[model samples]
Target: MNINLTLIGQSITFLAFVWFCWRFVWPPLLGVMQEREQKIASGLEEAERASKDLELARRKAAEQLKEAKEQAAEIIDGANKRANQIIEEAKNAAEAEGDRLKAAAKAEIEQEVNRAKEQLRSRVATLAVAGAEKILSVNIDAQAHDDLIEKLAAEL
Candidate 1:
Protein backbone atom coordinates (compact mmCIF):
# COMPACT_ATOMS: atom_id res chain seq x y z
CA MET A 1 0.00 0.00 0.00
CA ASN A 2 1.02 3.60 -0.67
CA ILE A 3 1.60 5.43 2.68
CA ASN A 4 -0.24 8.66 1.83
CA LEU A 5 -3.34 6.86 0.50
CA THR A 6 -3.52 4.57 3.54
CA LEU A 7 -3.30 7.53 5.88
CA ILE A 8 -6.09 9.41 4.08
CA GLY A 9 -8.47 6.36 4.14
CA GLN A 10 -7.95 5.71 7.90
CA SER A 11 -8.54 9.44 8.76
CA ILE A 12 -11.76 9.57 6.79
CA THR A 13 -13.11 6.41 8.48
CA PHE A 14 -12.30 7.81 12.01
CA LEU A 15 -14.12 11.12 11.28
CA ALA A 16 -17.25 9.28 9.95
CA PHE A 17 -17.36 7.02 13.04
CA VAL A 18 -17.12 10.01 15.39
CA TRP A 19 -19.97 11.79 13.57
CA PHE A 20 -22.25 8.72 13.70
CA CYS A 21 -21.69 8.20 17.49
CA TRP A 22 -22.41 11.87 18.22
CA ARG A 23 -25.67 11.95 16.30
CA PHE A 24 -27.11 8.58 17.34
CA VAL A 25 -25.72 7.73 20.86
CA TRP A 26 -24.54 10.89 22.82
CA PRO A 27 -27.97 12.60 23.39
CA PRO A 28 -29.69 9.55 24.95
CA LEU A 29 -26.65 8.77 27.20
CA LEU A 30 -26.62 12.36 28.47
CA GLY A 31 -30.38 12.16 29.23
CA VAL A 32 -29.91 8.92 31.19
CA MET A 33 -27.00 10.43 33.24
CA GLN A 34 -29.08 13.52 34.12
CA GLU A 35 -32.06 11.39 35.18
CA ARG A 36 -29.81 9.32 37.51
CA GLU A 37 -28.34 12.48 39.10
CA GLN A 38 -31.86 13.87 39.73
CA LYS A 39 -32.99 10.60 41.34
CA ILE A 40 -29.98 10.57 43.73
CA ALA A 41 -30.63 14.19 44.79
CA SER A 42 -34.33 13.41 45.49
CA GLY A 43 -33.34 10.34 47.60
CA LEU A 44 -30.96 12.45 49.74
CA GLU A 45 -33.75 15.04 50.34
CA GLU A 46 -36.21 12.31 51.46
CA ALA A 47 -33.69 10.91 53.97
CA GLU A 48 -33.13 14.37 55.53
CA ARG A 49 -36.91 14.84 55.89
CA ALA A 50 -37.26 11.50 57.68
CA SER A 51 -34.51 12.41 60.15
CA LYS A 52 -36.27 15.68 61.11
CA ASP A 53 -39.60 13.86 61.62
CA LEU A 54 -37.97 11.34 63.96
CA GLU A 55 -36.48 14.13 66.11
CA LEU A 56 -39.86 15.88 66.42
CA ALA A 57 -41.55 12.64 67.45
CA ARG A 58 -39.01 12.03 70.23
CA ARG A 59 -39.56 15.53 71.68
CA LYS A 60 -43.35 15.11 71.72
CA ALA A 61 -43.10 11.73 73.43
CA ALA A 62 -40.86 13.17 76.15
CA GLU A 63 -43.36 15.94 76.83
CA GLN A 64 -46.20 13.45 77.16
CA LEU A 65 -44.19 11.31 79.59
CA LYS A 66 -43.44 14.32 81.78
CA GLU A 67 -47.13 15.20 81.94
CA ALA A 68 -48.03 11.66 83.01
CA LYS A 69 -45.49 11.73 85.86
CA GLU A 70 -46.93 14.96 87.19
CA GLN A 71 -50.44 13.53 87.17
CA ALA A 72 -49.33 10.48 89.19
CA ALA A 73 -47.75 12.73 91.85
CA GLU A 74 -50.97 14.69 92.22
CA ILE A 75 -52.96 11.47 92.68
CA ILE A 76 -50.63 10.31 95.47
CA ASP A 77 -50.98 13.64 97.27
CA GLY A 78 -54.77 13.43 97.07
CA ALA A 79 -54.82 9.95 98.60
CA ASN A 80 -52.63 11.07 101.52
CA LYS A 81 -54.91 14.00 102.29
CA ARG A 82 -57.97 11.77 102.27
CA ALA A 83 -56.32 9.32 104.65
CA ASN A 84 -55.54 12.11 107.11
CA GLN A 85 -59.13 13.32 107.11
CA ILE A 86 -60.43 9.83 107.89
CA ILE A 87 -57.98 9.45 110.79
CA GLU A 88 -59.07 12.75 112.32
CA GLU A 89 -62.74 11.77 112.15
CA ALA A 90 -62.01 8.45 113.85
CA LYS A 91 -60.17 10.17 116.74
CA ASN A 92 -63.08 12.52 117.37
CA ALA A 93 -65.53 9.63 117.53
CA ALA A 94 -63.38 7.71 120.03
CA GLU A 95 -63.03 10.73 122.32
CA ALA A 96 -66.78 11.33 122.34
CA GLU A 97 -67.47 7.70 123.28
CA GLY A 98 -64.97 7.83 126.15
CA ASP A 99 -66.58 10.95 127.63
CA ARG A 100 -70.07 9.42 127.45
CA LEU A 101 -68.94 6.26 129.27
CA LYS A 102 -67.31 8.31 132.07
CA ALA A 103 -70.54 10.22 132.67
CA ALA A 104 -72.61 7.03 132.86
CA ALA A 105 -70.25 5.48 135.44
CA LYS A 106 -70.44 8.61 137.62
CA ALA A 107 -74.26 8.54 137.63
CA GLU A 108 -74.33 4.83 138.66
CA ILE A 109 -71.94 5.48 141.59
CA GLU A 110 -74.08 8.37 142.89
CA GLN A 111 -77.26 6.24 142.93
CA GLU A 112 -75.50 3.50 144.97
CA VAL A 113 -74.39 6.07 147.60
CA ASN A 114 -77.95 7.37 148.08
CA ARG A 115 -79.41 3.86 148.56
CA ALA A 116 -76.78 3.04 151.27
CA LYS A 117 -77.60 6.19 153.27
CA GLU A 118 -81.35 5.35 153.30
CA GLN A 119 -80.69 1.82 154.71
CA LEU A 120 -78.51 3.10 157.57
CA ARG A 121 -81.17 5.61 158.69
CA SER A 122 -83.90 2.91 158.90
CA ARG A 123 -81.68 0.66 161.05
CA VAL A 124 -80.81 3.43 163.54
CA ALA A 125 -84.49 4.35 164.02
CA THR A 126 -85.41 0.74 164.95
CA LEU A 127 -82.61 0.58 167.55
CA ALA A 128 -83.71 3.88 169.23
CA VAL A 129 -87.35 2.65 169.59
CA ALA A 130 -86.21 -0.62 171.24
CA GLY A 131 -84.10 1.29 173.80
CA ALA A 132 -86.92 3.69 174.72
CA GLU A 133 -89.37 0.81 175.35
CA LYS A 134 -86.82 -0.93 177.58
CA ILE A 135 -86.16 2.25 179.71
CA LEU A 136 -89.83 3.05 180.29
CA SER A 137 -90.71 -0.56 181.33
CA VAL A 138 -94.04 -0.39 179.46
CA ASN A 139 -95.26 -1.61 176.06
CA ILE A 140 -95.24 1.30 173.50
CA ASP A 141 -98.04 1.81 170.95
CA ALA A 142 -96.06 1.17 167.73
CA GLN A 143 -98.66 2.59 165.25
CA ALA A 144 -99.03 5.87 167.15
CA HIS A 145 -95.28 6.51 167.31
CA ASP A 146 -94.64 5.84 163.62
CA ASP A 147 -94.40 9.57 162.69
CA LEU A 148 -92.23 10.37 165.77
CA ILE A 149 -89.75 7.63 164.81
CA GLU A 150 -89.50 8.94 161.26
CA LYS A 151 -88.87 12.49 162.60
CA LEU A 152 -86.09 11.25 164.90
CA ALA A 153 -84.51 9.28 162.05
CA ALA A 154 -84.54 12.38 159.81
CA GLU A 155 -82.81 14.43 162.54
CA LEU A 156 -80.16 11.78 163.10
Candidate 2:
Protein backbone atom coordinates (compact mmCIF):
# COMPACT_ATOMS: atom_id res chain seq x y z
CA MET A 1 0.00 0.00 0.00
CA ASN A 2 1.19 3.62 -0.60
CA ILE A 3 1.93 5.75 2.48
CA ASN A 4 0.23 8.85 1.04
CA LEU A 5 -2.94 6.85 0.26
CA THR A 6 -3.03 5.39 3.83
CA LEU A 7 -2.55 8.87 5.34
CA ILE A 8 -5.35 10.27 3.17
CA GLY A 9 -7.73 7.43 4.29
CA GLN A 10 -6.99 8.03 8.02
CA SER A 11 -7.55 11.74 7.64
CA ILE A 12 -10.91 11.22 6.00
CA THR A 13 -12.01 8.74 8.72
CA PHE A 14 -10.91 11.18 11.51
CA LEU A 15 -12.87 14.03 9.93
CA ALA A 16 -16.04 11.88 9.59
CA PHE A 17 -15.74 10.77 13.27
CA VAL A 18 -15.31 14.40 14.50
CA TRP A 19 -18.33 15.54 12.44
CA PHE A 20 -20.52 12.69 13.84
CA CYS A 21 -19.58 13.52 17.46
CA TRP A 22 -20.29 17.22 16.89
CA ARG A 23 -23.71 16.56 15.40
CA PHE A 24 -24.96 13.78 17.77
CA VAL A 25 -22.84 13.29 21.00
CA TRP A 26 -21.67 16.87 21.55
CA PRO A 27 -25.17 18.48 21.40
CA PRO A 28 -26.67 16.24 24.16
CA LEU A 29 -23.68 16.83 26.43
CA LEU A 30 -23.83 20.61 25.89
CA GLY A 31 -27.59 20.60 26.54
CA VAL A 32 -27.16 18.71 29.82
CA MET A 33 -24.41 21.14 30.96
CA GLN A 34 -26.54 24.17 30.10
CA GLU A 35 -29.54 22.72 32.02
CA ARG A 36 -27.38 22.12 35.13
CA GLU A 37 -26.06 25.71 34.95
CA GLN A 38 -29.61 27.15 34.77
CA LYS A 39 -30.72 25.01 37.78
CA ILE A 40 -27.78 26.30 39.89
CA ALA A 41 -28.52 29.94 38.96
CA SER A 42 -32.20 29.58 39.94
CA GLY A 43 -31.23 27.97 43.26
CA LEU A 44 -28.89 30.90 44.06
CA GLU A 45 -31.66 33.35 43.25
CA GLU A 46 -34.08 31.53 45.63
CA ALA A 47 -31.48 31.62 48.39
CA GLU A 48 -31.03 35.37 47.97
CA ARG A 49 -34.79 35.92 48.11
CA ALA A 50 -35.04 33.86 51.31
CA SER A 51 -32.27 35.96 52.90
CA LYS A 52 -34.14 39.16 52.09
CA ASP A 53 -37.38 37.79 53.56
CA LEU A 54 -35.60 36.88 56.78
CA GLU A 55 -34.14 40.40 57.12
CA LEU A 56 -37.56 41.94 56.56
CA ALA A 57 -39.08 39.70 59.22
CA ARG A 58 -36.42 40.77 61.71
CA ARG A 59 -37.07 44.44 61.01
CA LYS A 60 -40.82 44.01 61.51
CA ALA A 61 -40.29 42.24 64.81
CA ALA A 62 -38.01 45.02 66.01
CA GLU A 63 -40.59 47.65 65.11
CA GLN A 64 -43.32 45.77 66.97
CA LEU A 65 -41.13 45.51 70.06
CA LYS A 66 -40.39 49.23 69.98
CA GLU A 67 -44.07 50.05 69.69
CA ALA A 68 -44.89 47.81 72.63
CA LYS A 69 -42.27 49.52 74.77
CA GLU A 70 -43.62 52.94 73.94
CA GLN A 71 -47.15 51.85 74.83
CA ALA A 72 -45.94 50.50 78.16
CA ALA A 73 -44.19 53.76 78.94
CA GLU A 74 -47.31 55.71 78.16
CA ILE A 75 -49.36 53.47 80.43
CA ILE A 76 -46.92 53.93 83.28
CA ASP A 77 -46.95 57.68 82.85
CA GLY A 78 -50.73 57.74 82.93
CA ALA A 79 -50.80 55.67 86.06
CA ASN A 80 -48.34 57.99 87.78
CA LYS A 81 -50.39 61.02 86.82
CA ARG A 82 -53.55 59.45 88.18
CA ALA A 83 -51.81 58.59 91.44
CA ASN A 84 -50.66 62.19 91.87
CA GLN A 85 -54.16 63.46 91.19
CA ILE A 86 -55.57 61.11 93.81
CA ILE A 87 -53.01 62.30 96.36
CA GLU A 88 -53.85 65.92 95.69
CA GLU A 89 -57.55 65.24 96.11
CA ALA A 90 -56.93 63.48 99.40
CA LYS A 91 -54.85 66.41 100.67
CA ASN A 92 -57.54 68.90 99.78
CA ALA A 93 -60.19 66.82 101.53
CA ALA A 94 -58.08 66.54 104.65
CA GLU A 95 -57.50 70.29 104.73
CA ALA A 96 -61.22 70.93 104.40
CA GLU A 97 -61.99 68.50 107.20
CA GLY A 98 -59.43 70.15 109.48
CA ASP A 99 -60.87 73.59 108.81
CA ARG A 100 -64.37 72.39 109.57
CA LEU A 101 -63.24 70.79 112.87
CA LYS A 102 -61.43 73.98 113.87
CA ALA A 103 -64.50 76.09 113.20
CA ALA A 104 -66.71 73.80 115.30
CA ALA A 105 -64.21 73.81 118.19
CA LYS A 106 -63.99 77.62 118.13
CA ALA A 107 -67.77 77.99 118.23
CA GLU A 108 -68.04 75.55 121.15
CA ILE A 109 -65.37 77.47 123.11
CA GLU A 110 -67.21 80.76 122.54
CA GLN A 111 -70.45 79.25 123.82
CA GLU A 112 -68.75 78.02 127.04
CA VAL A 113 -67.21 81.47 127.66
CA ASN A 114 -70.61 83.16 127.26
CA ARG A 115 -72.22 80.80 129.80
CA ALA A 116 -69.43 81.45 132.34
CA LYS A 117 -69.82 85.23 131.92
CA GLU A 118 -73.59 85.03 132.47
CA GLN A 119 -73.12 83.05 135.72
CA LEU A 120 -70.55 85.49 137.06
CA ARG A 121 -72.77 88.47 136.28
CA SER A 122 -75.70 86.99 138.25
CA ARG A 123 -73.44 86.26 141.22
CA VAL A 124 -72.02 89.81 141.24
CA ALA A 125 -75.56 91.26 141.15
CA THR A 126 -76.62 89.18 144.20
CA LEU A 127 -73.49 90.20 146.15
CA ALA A 128 -74.06 93.91 145.36
CA VAL A 129 -77.64 93.76 146.73
CA ALA A 130 -76.45 92.14 149.98
CA GLY A 131 -73.71 94.75 150.44
CA ALA A 132 -76.16 97.62 149.78
CA GLU A 133 -78.57 96.29 152.39
CA LYS A 134 -75.75 96.08 154.97
CA ILE A 135 -74.56 99.63 154.28
CA LEU A 136 -77.98 101.21 154.52
CA SER A 137 -79.02 99.14 157.56
CA VAL A 138 -82.58 99.35 156.22
CA ASN A 139 -84.89 96.75 154.73
CA ILE A 140 -84.85 97.51 150.99
CA ASP A 141 -87.94 96.29 149.13
CA ALA A 142 -86.25 93.50 147.17
CA GLN A 143 -88.90 93.13 144.48
CA ALA A 144 -89.03 96.90 143.88
CA HIS A 145 -85.20 97.09 143.60
CA ASP A 146 -85.08 94.28 141.04
CA ASP A 147 -84.90 96.65 138.07
CA LEU A 148 -82.06 98.61 139.74
CA ILE A 149 -80.10 95.40 140.36
CA GLU A 150 -80.63 94.28 136.78
CA LYS A 151 -79.25 97.62 135.49
CA LEU A 152 -76.18 97.33 137.76
CA ALA A 153 -75.55 93.76 136.59
CA ALA A 154 -75.74 94.89 132.98
CA GLU A 155 -73.18 97.66 133.66
CA LEU A 156 -70.81 95.27 135.41
Q: List the residue pairs that clash in candidate 1.
A: none
Scored against the true structure, residue 135 in model 2 reaches a CA lDDT of 44
lDDT of 1 by residue, 54-92 (tens): 999999999999999999999999999999999999999
lDDT of each: 0.83, 0.89
Predicted model with the maximum lDDT: 2
Q: Give the TM-score of candidate 2.
A: 0.55
Best candidate, TM-score: 1
The residue-by-residue lDDT of candidate 2 on 1-156, one tens digit each, is: 557888989999999999999999999999999999999999999999999999999999999999999999999999999999999999999999999999999999999888888887777867886767774586677775777667776787
Candidate 1 regions with alpha-carbon error over 4 angstroms:
1-28, 111-156
For candidate 2, give the lDDT of residue 25: 100
Q: Give me the displacement of residue 137 in model 1, in angstroms.
A: 8.8
